[model samples]
Target chain A: MKLMDKLQILADSAKYDVSCSSSGSSRSNRPGGVGNASLPGICHSWADDGRCISLLKVLFTNVCIYDCKYCVNRSSNDVRRASFTPDELCELTIQFYRRNYIEGLFLSSAVIRSPDYTMELMIKALRKLRHEYRFNGYIHIKSIPGADMRLVHEAGSLADRMSINIELPSVSGLKLLAPQKDPASILEPMGYVRERIMESRELVLYKKPQPFVPAGQSTQLIVGATRDSDLKILTLTEHLYRRYQLKRVYYSAYVPVNDDRNLPSVNTSPPLLREHRIYQADWLLRFYGFKAGELLDEGHPNLDTHLDPKCDWALRHLDQFPVEINKAPLEMLLRVPGIGYRMAAKIIRARRVGPLGFEDLKRMRVVLKRARYFITCNGRYYGGIDLDSGLLYQLLSDKTDSKVMAGQISMFG
Target chain B: MVYVTDGSFEGILTAVFEAFRNREDPEEITLGGDFQLSMTAGIREISTDTEKSDRVWRGVESKISKESLENLYMAYLSEHPRVGLYIYRYIKLGLNIGRKVEGYLQHPDVHAIYDLSRRVGSEAHLFLGILRFKKLRNGVFYACYEPDNNITQLITDHFASRLSDQAWIIHDRKRDILALFNGEEVIFTSGFPGIDHEDCEGEYEELWKRYFSAIAIESRKNPRLQRSFMPRRYWRHLPEKQL
Candidate 1:
């Protein structure tokens, strides 16, 4: 098949795995080399899906032996199958890199013949790019579930980031949908990679440094595919972060591509809002000091569709309202719904010079509409509605109007 | 005193130098051509002097931070007509209060200049991702972008370090300036028409477009969100946007 033909089929197959971040590693462009990785990743383009196109994400091939029901490349599916030769892959990547079309490559694949076989081919392409062509751009490769740990190690040394998709949120979901796959196969490689990454850092001074995925590791979860509650998902996310030290846990709104009885129907639209809310909660977990138990409990198993997780949490705890803006600490300032970590830090910095008034907050570009309710600027409560009034909830709720709500749905959904 | 400058970054710094030396407070510092006729009677024209500018630049570095110096230069690069006056006032304030000038957000003058500097820096940062380079027929990569602000110089180091092995040219078509880097050095040329040598396109463009469309999930198409990130104003030169 033609190179362009293979690119289309492979990229189409890989579109559903939506972790395209190219950040965290600063790979130097070697002398007489072609490219380098910037510390903060740059998004080359925004796809029509509204996702950032940071990498040239593609599968090495779409031909699979195991039939995972949620995947587009399931073995029973009669989709057009194609694969790129290692040489063709290298040629495509170099041309694209020099043209500034992508940061680097995100190489994934279906189980092509065997797990180790697929990994070896991926390592060959990566070696050619890094060694032969002297390409030093950011690469995020997928570790095949049952690939040899040695092969995974070889590939890890050459790439900047590596990820394994824990597609289902629960073991029950995996058993129901993909009985061929076991959770141990996925987590074992992840555990091994985590160990190696930690070991690389520990032996940094004593031994010749081995750069094993300098950008760290990430994982993805398929939201809304199974009957996983938000509490379950967020709990699992917190566990993954604490246990595996995962850099990111991307939640892909499960796009129903297959007609499996166990999965959602093909006509069902992906639960993008849920995915977005999970991301917000994930950020809170990572940046803001919010625990999963604080965000959700057994009583409230799902995030409110009308209110963001932060606002929902704030509404539930009204005694914390009217936080004194100037006197409040960074932790308290971040608890306000509209005030992000950036705004919180800015407040901390600016207030060190002079006390910030409501006017000053507005001038600093604070999202006062939402923040005013939760904060008192210089001891003046600007939020007209009483904190306990039901009207406060009405104002804070996102469903202000049908038109604007529709726009938000389209934007996030 | 109303001062007129040559409208370059150095010209603004020289105005700061002359202001300190002559001990005159500048009310409005306009560019040579931008000065209003009503203010022509007592206007003092400041020439670009590298020695004088460098002295003020070093003073800023010693008294404040290197970050503050970059901020001042970035604000000047905004090419605002009142930017010179803003810098003069900012320097007057910075000299006395030292590094605290950056934190005085309550002061309108300080806030206005810092805001402009921030916008310029952000534009420069955004162009790091948005700028596209096409391979020229002569084997050098060529790109032209119409950024909202002058940022070609700001983005030069990023592309230089990344594409060091290849020669490339970045053209700020909006400002009629070309930043040509021949793998070793960077040269800035201005007042030139925005036509370039032939681009060896077609194959790369087609392949990129195909990949772009194929990668977008049909169920998740949101053009408005796409526009919010990659604005329509920058779509004129992007290959995938053309398709």
Candidate 2:
């Protein structure tokens, strides 16, 4: 087949994997190298789904041997298959980099003939791109489950970041949808990569450090794939972060691409709002010092779709409200509905000059409408109404309703 | 009195220096080319004096933090109306209150300077991501951009550091300036007339367009969100946006 035809098929097949970030690694250009990786990632373009397209995300091939019921490129499905030679892949990366089309390359693949064989082809392409072409740009590649441990290590050394997708949240879900992939097959490679990263850190203390996934590893969880609750997903995500030292855990709302008896109906919309709630909860866990159990417990297994996770938490714990903004610590400031990390830091810095008032907060770009209810500046409260839980919830919901209506009009018009 | 400068960063600094030396708070400060005849005020044309500008810059560097110094430079690059007077007022405040003036977000002059500087900084950062290049027949990678701020000098260090092995030119068509890097060092020149070089018709460009179109999911098409991140103004230079 022609190259353009093959590219269309492969790229179409690869778009479902939504982990397109090329960040967190600062690999400098060598004396004769052609590129360097920026510390904060650059988004070269945004796809129609509002996701950043930083790297050239493509699959090495779209031919699979496993019959994963949820995947678009499952073995039983009848889709056009195409594969790129290692040379062709490397040449494409260099040419695109030269033309400033991408930050680097994000190479993934289906289980072509076998896990080991597919991984081997991916490593070959990466080796050529890194060593032969003298390209030092950011490269992120997927590690095939059940691949050899040695091959996984070699690939880790060459790429800036590596990821192993835990497609399902639980073991039973994996068995029902993708019986060929066991929990051990995925966790084993993750464990190996973690160990190598630790070893590389130790080496850096005394000797010249060898790079072993300097950007760290990340994984993806398919939400709405099974009947897994948000509690279950958060628990597993917490475990992965603690166990694997992962950089990021991406949540992809399940887009129904295949007609499977075990999956959601083909007409069902992806649980986008639920996915968004999960991401907000994830941010709180990572940055705001909230534990998974603290955010959700056995009683509350799902996030409130109408309100954000932070606001929901704040509404439930009103005793923490009316905190004096002039004297509140950083942690207390972060718990406010409209106060973000950046704004909290600014407040800390600004308070050094004198006591801050509501007017100062507005000038500092704080969302006074939402923050007014929770904070008091200099022993004075500017929130107009009484503090009743139901009334506050009603007020906030009314604001959200108007905002969503405005968004719909702007989007459609 | 109103002061008129030559529309350069140094010229603005020199005007500030003269304002402090004469101990006169000017009613307005504008570019010499853009100076309008105000029937109510006297106008003073300040020559571009490198010595006076350098002394004022040195005073600012010693009195304030390096971050504030860069913010002043970025605000000057914004070329916003009355930005010269705003910077002058900010510097005067910084000198009086020391570096703590930067965090005084409630002060109007300090706030205006920060706001203008933030716009220029954001624009330069956006161009870092959206600037696209095309390979010419002579193996020189070329790109054309029309940024809102005078950020050509600010963005060249990034490209020079990354693409050190290749020769490239970034033409700021809006400002009639070119930042050319020839595998070793970068030089800025405004003398070269714009060239219409024929781009190499490589097969990878075709593959790139195909990949870009194929990667977007049809079910969740939100062109508005895409435009919010990658604005419509940058689409002219993007290869994937064409055709």
Candidate 3:
């Protein structure tokens, strides 16, 4: 196939893997090199939904050996197959970089002939870009399941970031849908890479050789594909963070592309709202010092559709109401529904200057519409009867029109 | 009555400190030409004072965090004429509660400032990577930029260090600011020369245009998404946009 033809097919197939962030890495243009990745912010081409489209996100080949039901490029699907040579990809990336079209490459492939074969080809493509072409921009490569751990680490060293998609949340779901793939194959390489990175860091602590995987590792979980609850998904994400030291666990709301007996055949669009809520919960866990168990358990497996997880949790824990405005700690203030990290920091800073009154809270730009019910000013609560469940619900419903609700549910927004 | 200064960041910051001490009408603290033309009005030509300027600088610094101070600095570089007035208003809004300026992402006035700042900041950053230099006959490296934001001033330090040994002139064609480096010292002023834009086009430019065309995956072309990232307003200077 022509190079452009291959690009179209491969990029189309690769669009489903949506963890396309190019931020957080720091690489500058070499003496004669063409491109550089910024440290504080990445030069990303954002889609309408506000997701960054930085890399020339493409696959080496779309022809797969395994039939993962939720995947668009599964073996049985009637999609076109195209492959590119390493030189072709490198030339494309360099040319694109010169034109200010892209920052780098996000290259992945299906198991073309074997897991080792596919991985080796992927590594060759990246090595060609790095060593031969001297392209020093950001590169994110996918670790093939069941690929050799050594090969995974080799790819990890060359690329800025690496990701291994869990594909499905549960073992039984993987068994039912993609029997050829196993959780151990995915996590084993992840575990190996994790250890190698740790060892490299330990070596570098003594000012030795700078080590592997500088940008860390991330994983993706397919939401709404199986009957896995949000609670189960988050619990697994918590374990991945705590146990594997995973940098990010992206939740892609499943969009069924192939008709398969093992997968749930939903007639509606993917639960993008639920996936958004999961990201909010993920942020709370990562940055806001909340735990997975605090949000959900067996009883409330799914997040509430009407309210955000933070708001829902706040509503349920009504006994903690009217947290003193000036006296409450930063963490407690962050737990409130309307308050974000910025607002919490602002509240902390403002209170250090003087005792805060109700009017002062509004001047500080707190969302008093929601914070009023949850906060007390100088031990005086003006939120009497308004904090009642039925009345609060009515007020919230009245205030949150459909458009504002849509904006709240959107992760990109 | 208070006097409004010309719409420069230094001018606005000077007016802010002037309003801070003046016990006259506070609402008169606005941009240029807001005075009522009465004898009671005290119009002051606020020359750029680096000392009182640094004091207003300290106020912005002590009031908000470091990141916010940088953002306000960039926002003050926006192309909007009334941006000085808006920034003055924003700082007054911040004075009531020191951290109120920190939430620049949401508050309408602060968001307006932040949007301009982010545009200028990102453009300055993009120029660091994208701006190309050409060698003139006089051994001077000349580069022209038509930035949507007034980011030409931010490129001086970048070019100064990167091309330290070379004599160069970076002209912001739109804003009429020239950053001239004489291989020893750098100078900033407002003098932009006209150039025959068509005469400068050549093979490397053609090659760049070719690469841009070939890179787009035709089957997945979304012009809306493309426009969102590199807005059409910036395309006037880009070689690919000329194609």
TM-score of each: 0.95, 0.96, 0.78
Q: In candidate 2, which residue pairs clash?
A: none
Residues A86-138, model 2: lDDT tens digits: 88788888888877778899999999888899999999999988999999999
| Candidate 2 vs 3: which has more DockQ | 2
Top-down TM-score ranking: 2, 1, 3
Estimate, for each residue in A1-413, the C-alpha lDDT of model 1 and write its tens digit. Answer: 88889999999999988888888888898899989998878788888877888899999988999998888889999899999998888888889999899999999999999999999999999999899989999999999999999999999999999999998999999999889998999999988999999999898879988899989999999999999999999999999999999988988888999998898999998887778788888888988999999999999999987787899999999998889988998898999999988788878877887888989987887778899888887889998878887777778777632222111211111
Candidate 3 per-residue lDDT over residues A1-413, each given as its tens digit: 76656776777677667676665566665655545565544443434343454677888888899877788788888878888899988987775554345667888888899999999999999988988888777788999999988899899888877889997999999988888897899899888878888988798868865547666788889888889999999999999999899878888777766677676574546666677778889888887888999999888888876677788888778888879988999889989888888778867765665677887777555787777878898999867665655676555433432222120121221
- lDDT by residue (B1-243, candidate 3, tens digit) is 455666566777777776676633344444565545656665655555667767887877887656667877888777565576567677777877676556533355676776688778878876664565544545565777788777877877755644555677887888788888986677889866656555443544554444345434333334654565567776665555675
Error of 1 at B116 (Å): 1.9
Q: What's model 3's lDDT at B11?
A: 71
Residue pairs clashing in model 3 are none
Best by DockQ: 1
In candidate 1 the C-alpha lDDT for residue B204 amounts to 84
Q: Which stretches of candidate 3 lie over 4 Å from their true place?
A: A382-384, A397-413, B1-40, B47-72, B78-149, B152-243
What level of docking quality does candidate 1 show? medium
Q: Which one is best on TM-score?
A: 2
True contacts kept of each: 0.70, 0.66, 0.05
